[model samples]
Target: MTQEKYYFENPKSSIRSLTEDEIEAAIADYENGVKISEICQKYPKLKVSSFYKQLPYKLNQEKCEYCNNQIYTKVRKNGYGNDLAKLCIYCNHDYTKNCNCEQCFHNTNVALEEKRKELQIVWKNFYTEYYNLNYTLNDISIFDEIYLVLLIQSYKGTFENTLDFSYFKQLRFQVHASSHEYYSVINNLIDRKILIPNIYYFDSYDYIYSSEPSLPTINSTKINWIPNIIKTSGTLLSVSELDKILKERTYSVEDKKILWREVYWSEIKSYIDYQINI
Candidate 1:
């Protein structure tokens, strides 16, 4: 008979992982303000040394210029431990209490962007294949995730959200997604109960106030959560302005009409704001 050889564990060593009690005790001490160095001294055999080693920069901590205490900062690109500390954690928190400081704002933005990236990873495989789908859920990129949020904000009713295909088409270019791929993902979401089909409204610009009306109503909320923020070329387009541009331009001359539908998103606000500045 052949003896068993385990793949993940070392065959030569008799050591096994730490017990639940020991792991919990270590975590309790670390979270209560014990230094990593001290934790290593106590838990050398627990294999926490590797984790501490990866965070070498955090070890050097900077002293707050005002409070004269050690602080850790993630925004600073400098080596973790060697980062120049302008303020300790306490002082920094107090200063940004109002959230007006540029440093704090930048740091907050950094954090939001990190979260978006993290979500992108989470959404990477959220789609399923139980329904005979060709694409997997992980195909979702950062853009799709952002658009889902925008769609939620744009929805006006209790049951579902709606946007004209044309309006979505304009956005497709910015995110580098084609219409086929976009609809495929959307249909998948709908199948999953993540979306619902609302009553159909015309998306054409010419319908105006007539029985067949199609007007574009873009959302005007500036999405501060967008991390770097994406701005359209012009200011926000109001109903009146959209009507004027639609008539003035050749949009009416085409054989097929591109109607406007209501939409809620950052571009709606950002566009109007940009035009106002001009």
Candidate 2:
């Protein structure tokens, strides 16, 4: 007998992709409690694992609490080196500080202006007492009082507590006043003996008093005899101390007095008392 003829054949199978409709159907069936093995049998071209990978799932993202806009979150550290709160992506707003977005800028400015107004009231009250004690209350003008307060506030503890003449010029721009107004205030303060010429640069008093016939004008002029640096007869409070005083809610007159130079407080109190009695 002839040897039995044997034939072996290998069948080629191509992967058939599932359409969008087929994928949707599979996803629906899978979500409806259909077994993975059954679904794989139904679509044998792709594995159940592949089908599961294409399934939809909920995303882990955060939304802005204010506007419900999508925001990215990041892990930040706090002062103690711990995890901080989530920051808003749009406004840069966080739990720690105010938002920097344009929408929030108006509120921030309003808050700052309110704070400035409050501080102004406090400063006005604080300096009004000082102004009344130093000058005759009846003769005191709010304009002059404000100028005196501004001068004291601008004190920077320069040489022998002297301030540069240029600061007076700059004050005109700061308060939207004319150069004449600022200089006039300075002249008044000088004539009242509040601001004294810094005589430390002079070898003797004769140079200032040398019968040169000084003509006082409120406006800036070309005068060679004008002093560039001026000082107050009494020591002025330092900027840092004034800042501290401004921050504190309750500061006594005694506390304010102590802020001055130790040597001047007694004399200041004595003068204040004398003026009060007068």
Candidate 3:
């Protein structure tokens, strides 16, 4: 016979562990509104998630008085893509059957209501930021107004380039003016070189607005369109030109020239102050 290795002899127990009846009594104490931490203090082996599982089962057992069969098990279903679960029961007939009890209905409704409240808070923040940025009016030039309106519309990714007549009508009414007045303001901006028109052939709008002023076709290969804008002397500027100037050093000769041509002296001082603070 081969020799066998032994570790240690098992000792016989004199003291007895808690029986199933004792466990049931502890569970009853938990069901009768005893604090979980208190129970944990008494029984150090109890876990939190496991303790929470008992409450729902105990509550369901009391609510489900119709069937003599113990609710052997309870399962939760996806609450229609919500942060909630649908209470279900396993009966003697089938494991797949859902509980259509009144208590289950009430729980589902309450959960859905709570979810709606959470969603409303999220939507409130979104709308507040959107309205602050786009709707609230501040001291703005006609050029800035038109640019902002177009930019917002573009961001929405809905309306076409063609002006929304309804929006124009609403704005006209709000300003206590006509479409002609709005056009006149825009025309002044063009004359003052505040709003530079796009030169692309495809962007031409003859029906609703005045024809874009004639501009030299950009020589993409030979000349840098941006730097050329800084060099040229003209009343009307282009968007591409402005973009280029903004990219260079703020106090550059080109920048000063552009500022001298476009912005007032006080405005220039304020701009300098703002840039310094930033």
Candidate 4:
């Protein structure tokens, strides 16, 4: 009599629940290169991430060829699953165990060659413009040329057009220059208005005497040294304008910046090579 009490619930499935047949159809569509969004529309109950998680076991479990780890089964119709599972996220889609077949090697070299030629053209054009801008200043020293190129390269290569002032100290070591010579060269560039601070104009004396103002003397309220982020302010082609001018020749400002970065980085290394032993 106690066991006779029973409850009946509705037979409708939850929003996340999918029948086996629906899952099978979704998997078939995904394997055939259908977009995940399209599949989600076809089966409204599907969650992309959850559905993707289930993909690892959808077909027979297979080991990753590169990492030797168990992952999703392969699909011959399209290698989307294989690419998702095997490609290294950190390496820009390069396989962990890179393929060394002749085709792969040839493809890699051809891509590099094309990139090199493109960068060479960019360098030549920019160098011509840079030279034209500073041609009036005949006193441009070799160190000035090298330092300007390095600064442009760093501004374009780094995440932001900003760096710690101490970075120049590290560059001095890299280029085998003394502290005195390094600061002298920096001052020279600053005097020529090529390198300008990205921060507000401040006098070092304010930080040196940060004490409260007395009857006769006034001092800054701040106590810490202000950090400086240097920017390239070229006489002919400022860092801001360089990318804009180059954008006409490239895909975008970002792509042009990358090409400029590559060219200047190579130029910096070449300068370092010659200056290292001298």
Instruction: Give the number of the best model, judged by TM-score.
Output: 2
Residue 176 local lDDT, model 2: 22
* Cα displacement (Å) at residue 86, model 4: 7.0
Between the candidate structures 1 and 3, which one is better when assessed by lDDT? 1
Candidate 2 per-residue C-alpha lDDT over 76-140 given as tens digits, one digit per residue, 9 for 90 to 100: 21123334245454465443556566556767778767655554454344334433323232243
Worst 10 residues of 1 by lDDT: 220-229
| Per-candidate alpha-carbon RMSD to the true structure | 22.6, 24.3, 20.2, 23.4
lDDT of each: 0.36, 0.43, 0.35, 0.42
The TM-score measured for candidate 4 stands at 0.24
**Residue by residue across 65-142, what tens digits does model 3's lDDT show?**
434433332222213232222222432222223544655556567876665455445434432443232111223333
Summed backbone clashes in each candidate are: 18, 0, 0, 0
lDDT of 4 by residue, 1-278 (tens): 12111111222322226666765676678777799788888887766654454442322234444444333332333544354433221122334346554445667778767655554454444434433333322344333444554455443423233323335444542312332233354444543444433322222333222233221111212211111222244334444343343333325577556657766775787688668869
How far is 123's C-alpha from truth in model 4 (Å)? 36
Write down the TM-score for model 3.
0.23
Q: How close is candidate 1 to the true structure, as a TM-score?
A: 0.20
Please provide TM-scores, in order, for all candidate models, with all chains considered together.
Answer: 0.20, 0.27, 0.23, 0.24
lDDT of 2 at 201: 30
Q: Superpose all Cα atoms of candidate 4 onto the true structure and report the RMSD in Å to 1 decimal.
A: 23.4
Error of 1 at 116 (Å): 0.6
Deviation of model 4 at 168, angstroms: 6.6
Q: In model 1, what is the error at residue 168, expressed in angstroms?
A: 16
lDDT: worst 10-residue window of model 4: 1-10
Q: Give a tens-digit lDDT track for model 1, residues 1-278.
A: 22112111132321134354654455456445576567667767644434422221121244554555554432222234432323233445334345434566777778767655544333222312221232222333333444454443443233122333333344432322332222344433444433322212222212212221222221211111111111254232222332243345433323222122212343475577667769
